[model samples]
Target: MIDFITGRGLLLLSLRRMYELWVNHSSQIIKQFSILIGLPLEMSNNSDSSLEVFSPAKFPKAMNELSALLEAIAATSIYFKAEIVVSYIKSHSLRIEWIEANPALAKIVTSGLLKTFSLETLFEANRNNKNFLRDVENHISKQLLAG
Candidate 1:
């Protein structure tokens, strides 16, 4: 259908239609993601500023914090993501701070993850390798710590 329309010299029309579809779809997607990530979203009719896509502009801090937490789970996960990131920061005496976090780190992360991802989604992502999330955590700890 796209080729059919574009070949007939309705290229601008087709592009406009695709953009419309994208705007409609992305708003819905953003809303769902906001709920999952436990973030507030306010969409106003007068602004195109809210249409931005996800980027590392604000995620690196979150990633580093998450990496710090996952360090307790399995040492390799964070190292593999950024080689020597943890050790190098420590050696240089660089401090990475979290933005207003709870005292209970594990519970905080688990609650956020539970909100962000459903069991069905997790199972699908892991190809149904383990049925229980606790088992998954234990398995990683055992495997990484043993080796």
Candidate 2:
């Protein structure tokens, strides 16, 4: 029985190490790709893991790519059991501040954007959720254009 318990503990340790390695490898890949594509990606390992993708142009295609990358990360998080919060920062810092100041608008926009991903669905990342991207793009366009 003691030997069995020791073997089980070792197995668990190995699995955890593998998960950590995969997470690190995946993050590096994402960072490299973001740099190659000229997108500024910042990942933070605070209490709540968060990824911030800075879009200098706020282009639709760029947003789409960001959404795809986010979905991929979300899919991977299932096995690793991590919750990742994603944020998009536009080029205009003032605009982001304005959005944050307006709690109602912030909630609406955030909810609309997150609606694209069924995060409750474990192990499946909806990388092809273009509708969510469209919704987010439309909302941002309207806000920026109106201003």
Candidate 3:
């Protein structure tokens, strides 16, 4: 899926741009791109405090810009931090549906990242399962058991 998605020119361009924009842009660069081109992507990193914020926006008329950026971040986060994301997904089953809904996500979260969002991912069965929606049918029929 990653190969297929990157095959598309626009999606490919968006991926490259996301990689390029991880760091916050300088003021002059922001003014030139944000004002002139209508892409205002900013990521702040503070050494004093362990906090990072991502702000990416597009013109009001455009719809997919922010979605694509956010999808990219989700993809990369899953790619880089599979364990954390996978655990979160397990506790929140709907999260996988959200990930699967996005074409960019299906494409970007390739390689082993696909496993991170798969419904089959096994999670620890503990107190956290309290809120875990049991969408998967756990029942086995008598016919199947006999077979």
- Each model's TM-score? 0.29, 0.25, 0.18
Query: What's model 1's lDDT at 2?
Result: 54
Over the stretch 20-127, how does candidate 1's per-residue lDDT look in tens digits? 888879989877875664333553343553243332233333334434445544423322222122222222122233212222333333343322232223323333
Instruction: Provide the global lDDT of candidate 2 against the true structure.
Output: 0.40
Q: Which regions of candidate 2 deviate over 4 angstroms?
A: 1-7, 23-26, 36-38, 43-147
Full-model lDDT for every candidate: 0.39, 0.40, 0.35
Give the best candidate by TM-score: 1
lDDT of 3 by residue, 41-96 (tens): 44244542124321212232122332333344442423223323333334532245
Error of 3 at 69 (Å): 14
Write down the worst ten-residue block by lDDT for model 2: 118-127
Tens-place lDDT per residue, model 2, 1-147, is 112345777878777777887887988987776565444454334333223222325334444544544553332222111111223232112244545445444443345444333222210211244444345445544434333
Worst 10-residue stretch by lDDT in candidate 1?
86-95
Model 1 misses residue 89 by how many Å? 12
TM-score of 1: 0.29
